[model samples]
Target: MSRAAIVVAAVACAACSGRMPVLDPGGPQAARIATYWWIVFWLSALILAAVVAFLLHTLAHRRVAAAPASLVEDTRVERRLALGVAAAVGLTALTLVVLLVTSVATGRALRSFGGTDPLTLEVTGYQWWWDVEYWDPVPSQRVRTANEIHIPVGRPVLVKTRSLDVIHSFWVPGLHGKKDNIPGHGSSLVLQADRAGTFIGRCAEFCGVQHAHMQLLVIADQPEVFDAWLQAQRRSAVVPTDAFARHGFDLFMTGPCALCHTVLGTPAGGRRGPDLTHLASRRTLAAGTLPNTVGHLAGWIIDPQAQKPGAQMPGNAFGADDLSALLAFLGGLS
Candidate 1:
């Protein structure tokens, strides 16, 4: 094939490849945006077909090529062209107005709240980690815990988003797109999942060196399962009679860890990192990027910067037993 032909073939192949196309609209807002694109695509295709057919007809029937200058412009033809342009402009404006109105309506539906019946979650973003806090507003009931957020499949979840140091985004691909977590100001995102499964989420904005490693999960489950999970999370951190776990707890509280992290039901009052109140219950550590296991947790505890560059956590210079105790104490948080 000629170079031009090869270039055309490449362009066609690129157009046909849907590898990164936004095939699925997970949320209502995304669905609306996808629908708008679909309408525009088909309409453009129809216009192109009409224009091509008209050009072919004109070329086939032309008597003398390049001799139409003597025909002169017709006033009626000019008037019809002006009317067509005006109609096109008016229709475009009307379409834009309709789209704006519908977008606002869909947004309102997504953000609608029940009268004090919805589950409220506090989602705080660190440099590259996600700090999840489930708020149980009821006085007597304890809220269950997990790193990733979980909600009932059919009910709307109200999430209040915040940031500690830099901006991060909360995005659950199969549920909702994202909302920015800006420091000093709170933003709210209302979303729901229509099905029950684990959906992958990621930090949509870059914050630091580990920004690419920061990811999260959204678990949509039946209400009963969510309730049980919550109960497990709210249980107090394990007060281990085992020497290793007890030593780890001591190392955690007395070492530099206490100055930067928080563990509920204990005196570690730090607020710089994620709350370790229920760390073991979380499926993934390091902001949902690493699996929660003894080895990974040990690595994180010993030298966090090696795993997560630019992390605010410093490496602990403790011995193996002390590290084991810390890992044991953390592992029992679930």
Candidate 2:
């Protein structure tokens, strides 16, 4: 292909890959940050233009020979230069004050949690995945889900953050700014989506080898839809009625998988891994490393390390029949 054709192809591929969340503001906090970004961008651009203009003017009016020493040290010229320097300094200070005030105001707005009883969520960052817990006054209303967060649109949601292991930053760029999840320290941020959409989130801090793949999805839905999803997530795993699924469930409960994963409403109550109560409902597995399809599920079950190098999950060797049955049981989790 020609060079132009290759360039076009590259641009087309980038367009198809979706937008970076920081450039796409889906909420008030992100919009506020974007405003600050634009202010800085325009100010920088203006400074660059002024410097370029002065350089070009100097070049165009080049002196053929050196000026006289008396003219160089002229009192009027020295006074004008001093005034120019002072004016520049004053303008620069004024500009900085404006930026500081704007930044402080925006920060205050982002931290403000004034709303009709915001939904509370505790997000604990792990080695390479997020453990999310929805908080509620009623014990039964609380739900635990991993790598995905569902929230109602147009409502404030306060997310309390912590790190189970090393420091990790919780950042959903389309919704809010990055907040560090420090061990032994509690930090919180408020998020509110103005519209319904699926926004991508990721670990902003580098924690380990699989840090690049540490991702999450924020699904903003209508109140009713969010409530339905919450209710489904709070429920326990469904019991399989079919022979293949039943056999698979028995195997899962008895096998090594039960030691790490939890299936609510069952005897398998392991806490080391992500909750599998509604595993099928999630869009991705292994912290967004792979799509949550039957084929991917089978592959992940057989050899997790091959997919995620530093993943905590070890490979499990299962026969074809058992793998098929296990896939059947897991696929019905939703």
- Give each prediction's root-mean-square deviation over alpha carbons: 6.5, 4.1
lDDT of each model, Cα atoms only? 0.73, 0.89
lDDT of 2 by residue, 210-308 (tens): 887788899999999998898889888889999999999999999998998888888888989888889999999988778899999999999988988
Task: Give the CA lDDT, 0 to 100, for residue 334 in model 1.
Answer: 75
Candidate 2: the clashing residue pairs are none
Where model 1 places Cα greater than 4 Å from the true spot, the runs are 1-72, 75-91, 94-98, 113-116, 138-147
Candidate 1's displacement at residue 258, Å, is: 2.5
Query: Where's the lowest-lDDT run of ten residues in candidate 2?
Result: 11-20
TM-score of model 2 vs. true structure: 0.92
Itemize residue pairs with steric clashes in candidate 1: 144-230, 248-325, 248-326
> Which numbered prediction scores highest in lDDT against the true structure?
2
